[model samples]
Target: MLQGMRLTADKEHIAVVLNRPKYAGNIGSAARCAKNMGVERLMVVSDRDYPQEEIRQMSTHLAADVVDSIVYCRDLGEALSGFHYVVGTTARLGLARGPVMSPRDMAEQVVELSRKNDVALLFGPEDTGLTNEDLRYCQSVVSIPTSERFRSLNLSHAVMILCYEISMAEIGVPERFTPKMASSRETEGMYGHIGALLQEIGFLNPENPEYWMMHIRRLFSRMRLSAREVRIIRGICRQLSWYLHHRG
Candidate 1:
């Protein structure tokens, strides 16, 4: 299901890292935005108390999966690790930082980076943006072009806008044929193929299959694998299986 593929977290490589977000409602809104944009992983780092339960409750049915999947971190650096590139979203211009780009330009750069490595789009707390220390971790800073007089946006609004821009970038790729939304059966079959391959490669340990499956899901969920991409991936897996079986 192409539509389902777009809705699932398996559609994007981007992860949202929230730094010291205060309100549970804000977190819930961010989760919803993440779900809409197919963002799978949500890393929240805060020294202060974050109402996890409230967020889960407020996320409703749409963001329930994302709220449940959130990972809590002690600090920004720990949350940002393993990501190849990081972008800090900010509205203010600092004396040291360079010029800001619109969401479209930023998303273009993000799409390029997504092809190569894991990317983290960091958002600071509602009241204060990235601290000087937090900024150190990002490779680049992104500012959504807004009216010069007023630029600040709600945390969830910012996330939604960023995701919309990213989605727009991938809307029409002439090289790839966009199939109609794949049915649940089709998706399940595709996942089965991937699971079998992972088991063969020892990524999904047979002894602790369930444990390994969860980990594997975490990995693939972040990729936001498209319907067409899933088919291509399964084909590769099949070819690998054929080669392995015939070689002997």
Candidate 2:
């Protein structure tokens, strides 16, 4: 009778992460928003201390569970370390943000993605938003469109928008099994291997290798590498390293 639950199970597979949030009230509000959309996992990446009473007051009783269960991390990388797919949200965009997707569009992808992989929807701080350096771990990014006259959005408002779209996605029904992507740990290890190998081969400039590696990251992000694929790439890097050492 309740077949129209609209994929409530997807909630378990997705985590809403706040990066370096400045306000405890906003964190609480974000938790309430996440709970409203059935998004259960809440993680906060911050070093600052926020009053627990203020947070619980803002969260209220409805989302007390979420606020109480929040996971704390020192940084974004550590916060999303266990996730397989990471999506970052930003108000400012340029070459560093990489290709951007609309919230609705990204939510559509999330429905399928969350079915097979642990997905992280990352949001930045209240003022500056996500920095270019912070986006290194994200596979892709989504930017919410607002009036050109005033572009910035409230932190909790942004969280509500993303969670709302994910909750209401039309393609929420499971059609097929999606292959799981590699976890952040696996992918980051693979990227590290590739970066060092490219540096050794002089394919990436030694002076500023990250500039070149950024492009490589985007290229591979599109490939949606699985754990097996990551292993294969790392294996290739190992073989290449051996050849370079032995051929001499």
Candidate topping TM-score? 2
Top of the candidates by lDDT = 2
**Per-candidate RMSD, Å:** 12.9, 2.6
Residue 211 of candidate 2: its Cα lDDT?
A: 97
Q: How much RMSD separates candidate 1 from the native structure?
A: 12.9
User: Relative to the true structure, how large is the alpha-carbon lDDT of every model?
Assistant: 0.70, 0.89
* Candidate 1: worst-modelled 10 consecutive residues by lDDT: 1-10
TM-scores vs. true structure, each candidate: 0.62, 0.94
**Alpha-carbon runs more than 4 Å astray in model 1:** 1-11, 171-248
lDDT of 1: 0.70
Cα deviation in Å at residue 62, candidate 2? 0.7
Residue-wise lDDT of candidate 2 within 119-220, one digit each (tens)? 999998899998888888999899999999999799989999999998888564565557999999899999999998998898998888899889989999
